[model samples]
Target: MTTIKASCPSCGDVELTPHQVRLVVCSVKSWSYYAFICTTCHEEVRKPAGRDVVALLISGGVVAEPWNVPAEVLEEHEGPTLNYDDVLDFALWLEQADLLAAAAAAQGPRPRAQAPETAA
Candidate 1:
């Protein structure tokens, strides 16, 4: 198997095979990132991949995964801009409600069924 050399923050220089590195390409901003599991420290490492680096990784046979921004996030919003005050207000309000319980509440209560017609 082909080996690719990469630097691990904790372990300095390390060699990883093509199968060890995974490439993540972001379509939104033409950005790419490399993710790998460091062998020496057994830690997950991720770093931005520039154009030249991306080409090198691709040449090494690493799998490339493309990602794009969600459609909902692209939609325009007209809401007021949030500020520190808003965050403080929310924090205060959150304390009043059982936030966790409310979030865990079931979908909603079903409407009561209508009584069958009774002939007098």
Candidate 2:
């Protein structure tokens, strides 16, 4: 069996093992799928990817997208996920992306909400 080591970011322990598959079932949804989880810690490693798939794309570290992306397009462009070092890189990239997104949003759409005009 192939093994990889990772430090547990949550507990500051160097006991995390290489990727392993875990099946999760939600109470509300019966759909189940295997996810890569930390071997030692057992925390779903895919949590970050699921939470912010778009941000991961902007950060250029959409790790989980490759396996999940359709096969036909895989030959053209493949998305590799972040390793430990890649996580650091992702942070910097996301920071820049967030700034750009914010700037664009500020310059573009503005919502207008007005209460009904009250009679004097």
Candidate 3:
């Protein structure tokens, strides 16, 4: 069994086995991280795992877990932030709005058919 060395904020240094370490490699590079429980304080410690650290841990028998975050979750939007009152207003409006009727109204009135010209 391999002994892995990790540091805890409260406990300083602690030893861990490969099984005791959790390595997560995220789809987003900066989100990759490793976590372990400190032996002395029994507190869970988590740290960012860069490429080099990830490779080292994997080489030492630690299994890497994959985290795939959706792109939409990270997108930037330009708009006014919605507040609780805005959400409540929309919910209230939804309850009374006739969605089907509104959709029909949006299409506007159909063009009137022209009467056939009377024969001379």
Candidate 4:
């Protein structure tokens, strides 16, 4: 069978079959890329490929590898926007301890003031 020839940046053009090239598709990119170890220099080479190149590579029998991007990228932020004052408040709160106790210490334990008895 006739073998396809590919040129390696590190090494000159070498004879290899289509299956020898590795094609990777990343979800974040509209294009795909390929990596192949040069038979001449034994070094790996990677290059980006457009749709046409991708089709050609697949048609030529290159192995396909797929990768997915993180789902958090699509998630929306519904919480309130933070400002400098808000950040300062949060930092101060973090530095404090026993919030309930601090509140109680500030206000001595005392029964709620009762309304004066109303005369009929």
Query: All candidates' TM-scores?
Result: 0.60, 0.24, 0.72, 0.53
lDDT of 2 by residue, 40-70 (tens): 6666554332323333332432222223334
- Candidate 3's C-alpha runs over 4 A off are 91-120
- What is the alpha-carbon lDDT of model 1 when measured against the actual structure? 0.86
lDDT of 1 at 91: 92
How many residue pairs in model 4 have overlapping backbones? Answer: 0
The lDDT, on a scale of 0 to 1, for candidate 2 is: 0.47
Tens digit of per-residue lDDT, candidate 1, span 1-120: 778999999999999998899998887645679989999999999999987888899999988888887889778989898999999999988876666656657556668999999999
For residue 14, model 2's alpha carbon misses the true position, in angstroms, by: 32
- Best of the candidates, TM-score: 3
Report the CA-based lDDT of candidate 3 relative to the real structure: 0.95
Best by lDDT: 3
Weakest 10 consecutive residues, lDDT, candidate 3?
95-104
Per-residue error for 87 in candidate 1, Å, reads 12
Q: List, residue by residue over 6-43, the lDDT tens digit for candidate 3.
A: 99999798999999999999999899999998888888
